[model samples]
Target: MQLGCWQDCIGAIDGTHVSAWVTGPDTATYFGRKYCHTQNIMAACDFDMCFIFISCGWEGSMHDSRIFNEILINDNVTFPHPEEGKYYLVDASYPNRVGYLALFKGNRYHQQQFRRSQQNRTAKTSRELFNKVHSSLRSVVKRTFGAWKNRWGFIRDMPRYDFANVQVLLVSASMALHNYIRRNTGNPTTVHLICDEEEAMTIVNAIPEVEHDNDDLMVGDEDPQMALMRLRIRDKLVYLRNNGMLENI
Candidate 1:
């Protein structure tokens, strides 16, 4: 659960597409990138693999960024708001705003990619080091999704529920059940055990350092202030790395 220098990070945010059945005028809307009817489920999860917030029922074809923006616009207060100087770790698909930290776009960021590249040598630049750490920490959300789908067959291959209400009900009930199990009997370690030993060790040894590669930076449409905040945070991460403090974490 240690997020290295990002101790103020509360959780991770990502979207998962769940297959669904739809008809009539809504059929096209639900047809997603997978070439099937689905629901783009936006979820936030803590380090323990427990979901903190979930927003379901968006069209499968909708972009993840769009869904997140809609959530902020429609239910800003209800959505989990990070405290001052706190943020959530999000993937490149999300905007690098004050409340959310995103990985450097066009950089090596996936766990598999990092492992492969690191096999030869460690990260060479600050951005590479940052991405290495970012990928390792953000993997919790991916594992959470895997564990969730493995446990609930209904969500894996959702039956043909003709009504949207029924589909939403099923989705909500499944998420509730997931939380209940996690809170009661779930072992956080077991969720991560699905990975092989080498990969696990890679994550453990991923102590990031700062670099100076700002080429093709993807800051998205963030306002100037938020963009600067993001840069400051990255600089802070680099500072910690160079000072040998990040390794102790």
Candidate 2:
């Protein structure tokens, strides 16, 4: 994670909904916000676009934060957890907690916004600049998801299986294969081939809206300790930017 001032960042965490076919009593449980039966697949990926952790089998209707807290947090999953002073970059769907660093909500923090700022060469405010860097670094997770789904057609539209557990197994196997290919080949062209510009843009635009019911209560109620930590990190990033350390990137 060589994200300028965010070098302590271990990885990025996010969730992607995979279409699933279900019937009978379980259909209602799998019906998701997209008006389709699906499975919410949560994953953590490093800066190199390699998946470090993945958790599937959660119902599509489940909130990302809930899946994270229940499956990853309560279960003591240490793979995604970072060491002291390290954190994973997450989206607005997750809380701005100590171990997780979320972008500044209600602010411009997307690739489009960053590109526009770069084109104008406009000196951005501290928060805007922080968000610019945050968005760029976090995009790796989105690209990884897009490339994985594009590489494996089954994940894009999973077929109806006799057993629901098979869906989970398929997803696990796909991720394992994805990692194997990435490690053995040591080539980024494979990832780029799967996730073209159009496909990547589609995935970015298709990101599900934040679940208001799950996030509304926590909005604007950030813990004082966590708030201070964010401030320190933001200031350090600004310092790095001022010193021209990030201009090349």
Candidate 3:
């Protein structure tokens, strides 16, 4: 909502590869497209950059869609089921299912960040408006991940530790402490590491080297109710923009 999204936009969800040093046979399982031993850490964070949910300990080779489906089916996962009419922003890699909003398929939407030349990028249609708004709001998770990694040097140059403890201790503890600093501070952004690195830690699929998966995307069969919700949101965003209630972004 802070990014001009509707009140129903609760937060953003995405997966990141936490670099690790695993021994022996586990190296093969942990090696991903980035050519490093990483554990796929799926997390959800709100506008305040607090990780409200985290599912770690997955192999880096595992696809996000596969992990997401597994989390849904597995009764053990305490996935925070959103209240009715609320949803979390996800990327093209995730399915457009209930409680998870994604970009509108077949639309020419903006990427993670905009260039100076693309500043004039406007929504000519309702679908474009929805796409623009959704993409902007969904970027919170990327920014949160960026700040988290930047604040903790250990995540970048990880030291040797038990593979299981890497997820439970380092990953979870970092996020928990990140939340503490973020919540306790007046300006959390100011406390972010004074580094020269990029600010947005986008999903791997958004990277040029890592290719996007074709199957299980939003283009496939999705929840009928969610499809309708997307339509309504598209129309609503256009309406708000036309009346000057919403910005062209």
For model 3, the superposed segments whose C-alpha errors exceed 4 Å read: 1-5, 112-120, 188-219
Model 2 C-alpha lDDT per residue in residues 1-249, reported as the tens digit of each score: 123345467789999998887778877888989898888888999877889999877789999988877865465665557777888888888878877888777767776765565564443676666667777778889988988888999887788784367888898899888888878886653222223546544543443333223332334746444555556556666655565545633
lDDT: worst 10-residue window of model 2: 209-218
- Candidate 1's displacement at residue 248, Å, is 14
Higher-TM-score candidate among 2 and 3?
A: 3
Candidate 1 lDDT, 1-249, residue by residue in tens: 224355567889999988887889888999989998898999999988889999888899999999999998885538988888888889878888878888777767776664564453455566777777777788889988898888888886888886478987788778878878988895655323434656534543464434434443454556444455455456665665666645522
Clashing residue pairs, backbone N/CA/C < 3 A, model 3: none
TM-score of each: 0.79, 0.78, 0.81
Q: Is candidate 1 or candidate 2 better by TM-score?
A: 1
| Candidate achieving the largest TM-score | 3
Which 10-residue span in candidate 3 carries the lowest summed lDDT? Answer: 196-205
Give model 3 RMSD, 1 decimal: 10.1
Q: Against the unseen true structure, what C-alpha lDDT does each candidate score?
A: 0.74, 0.72, 0.73
Clashing pairs in 2: none
Q: Pick the candidate with the highest lDDT.
A: 1
Model 2 misses residue 79 by how many Å?
Answer: 4.7
RMSD of every candidate to native, in Å, equals: 6.3, 10.0, 10.1
